[model samples]
Target: MGGLLLVAITGIALVVGISVGIGDLPIPLATTFSAVTNRMGWTAIELNRIHETVIWDYRLSRALVAVFCGAGLALSGAILQSLLRNPLAEPYVLGISAGASTGTVAVVILGLGAGTISLSAGAFAGAFAAFCFVALLSNGARGGPDRTILAGVAASQLFNAATSYIVTTAGNAQQARDVMFWLLGSFGGVRWPEFALVSVVVGFGLIACLLHARMLDAFAFGDETAASLGINVGRAKLALFALTAMMTATIVSMVGTIGFVGLVVPHAARFLVGPLHVRLLPACAFTGAIFMVLADIASRALIPQQVLPIGVVTALVGVPFFCLILYRYQRVS
Candidate 1:
């Protein structure tokens, strides 16, 4: 019932988002849907070139990217929480976001925007490096969850310091502003080719993670119990770690460091559904998609003649909700 309700809410939210996109535009919802259907060859209806271009080229691409980014982050959070056995476990918890930001800043600061290798590539490299470092540290410690969490905290702080130094020393004002905005995150300025790349990476990663949901459920019981149940705990963890790193890197590369969707959405899903990975993972993905789409809408519509960063909107929404969840968890405990 809970899962069904979540799905229903997400569906409603998606519809609302589509309607919101039509705001202040000359396009009607029926016309928009007709344009989409005609494009997909479901019906033979003529669309004005302007309306078709607006719906197909700009609004649809942005909305879909928002959905993909939200779902990917939430799925990554679910996997991390299960693997670490920590409610607070998220991709950003281990300095991956900070590292990615630093690398992006490096690209902008050095004026390295030409060629196939851009700031996105640099961010991916940084995120992957940070993930590897944290994974090694987590594995080396016999102390388990606490040690892993501590290592992540330490890493996050170190990487943040590096990011700060780079921002302060940047020579050009435009470069500094660019780096700052990237760190804040946005879905604006994204093109179709970039969106397609992100979709492929996120889709593959989500499928891979869902395939191992059963192993994750076993791990939730405890490492010893998982081993007893014939699960190769170490191998499973390693594979998940790599998959998550790749996904996180891909997202951070494209969208910059949007935090809390991964951390907050998974916990919210777990609160509604139980700790069962099968139910929890899909619920988290759907809810996260809803959350981000709404956030993106709010970001665009909140101010007149100015667009806000999507990260700022998410942070505003996520921080209060996260605090509420923490309060409830403490009360229950």
Candidate 2:
């Protein structure tokens, strides 16, 4: 686990270096490192002001946003999988992403939130509403994991229909195009403020998950088994579920719906570090951060003069791995 963590750290540094040095106004790795260190007062290296702005103000902030959002999503997936005992469980499976999309589209298309609140605020509210809807349905079914999953699917379909209606009718062609782009995910305008918010939120999320790591381990078995082990099964499930929902909602609000990180990273981490949440959770965060940073870089560099959606890059990379996991699971079963 320690070795894996070290490797992950090294990989993150290398990726960040590459990301900082890529793009239209490319900078050297040495200049990128020196610019960063100069900001920290570690070294005084003369860099062009335009290069500094491009590297520090834009590219670096975008990279940080990817790191935080990726870590948050992966951590959320890990917790959900453990709590529900479902290998396929993910951060946005409960319609949180759909709800966020609906709210953002409403704000963007209908101008519902014209002045008072921002689109992200609307998204957070919508995501919470979706989670509450799922909770109500699951509770009526006696709060089992299977019931929760079914309720989530129902809620997702409902929210998705609402989103489609808003986009098709209320929005014009350009508005629809923008909404679709957002839904597919991009980090185009990410700056220090968004990065700071995500950093704090994802940091708290990681701490909360770490604090409850043992409860998650217990949850991996049946709820009865967890209860027999003196864990408050109901309370733990609710806490973990809410934690994941909040984390996922925050990320989707900031960056729209980037898929596959949440779905695929936890499984990959588990493969590396095993199922113990103590080691598994951090590993997921680290691996997911790296995956997302690389994906963001690919989104920029894949085609000349055209940027692809971050979600598209992730899905392209993740789909084959996802199929492999499913195939292996079936074979083992």
Best by lDDT: 2
Q: Which pairs clash (backbone N, Cα, C closer than 3 Å) in model 1?
A: none
How many clashes does the backbone of model 1 have?
Answer: 0
lDDT score, candidate 1, position 94: 68
- Please, what are the lDDT tens digits per residue for candidate 1 over residues 207-243? 8877998999988877887899898988988888777
On a 0 to 1 TM-score scale, where does candidate 2 land against the true structure?
0.90
Model 2: residue 5 alpha-carbon error in angstroms: 3.9
How many angstroms is residue 162 displaced in model 2 relative to the true structure, after the best TM-score fit? Answer: 1.4
TM-score, cand. 1? 0.86
Q: Write the per-residue lDDT of candidate 2 for residues 1-333, one digit (tens) a residue.
A: 577768888898888888888888888888888888999999998889998989988888988899998999899889877876766667566677788777777776777867687776777777778877887888843576557767878888998889889999988898778778888899997889999888998899999999999888887877778899999977887787778767777788778888768879998888888999999999989988998999999999999889999989988977787678667766776
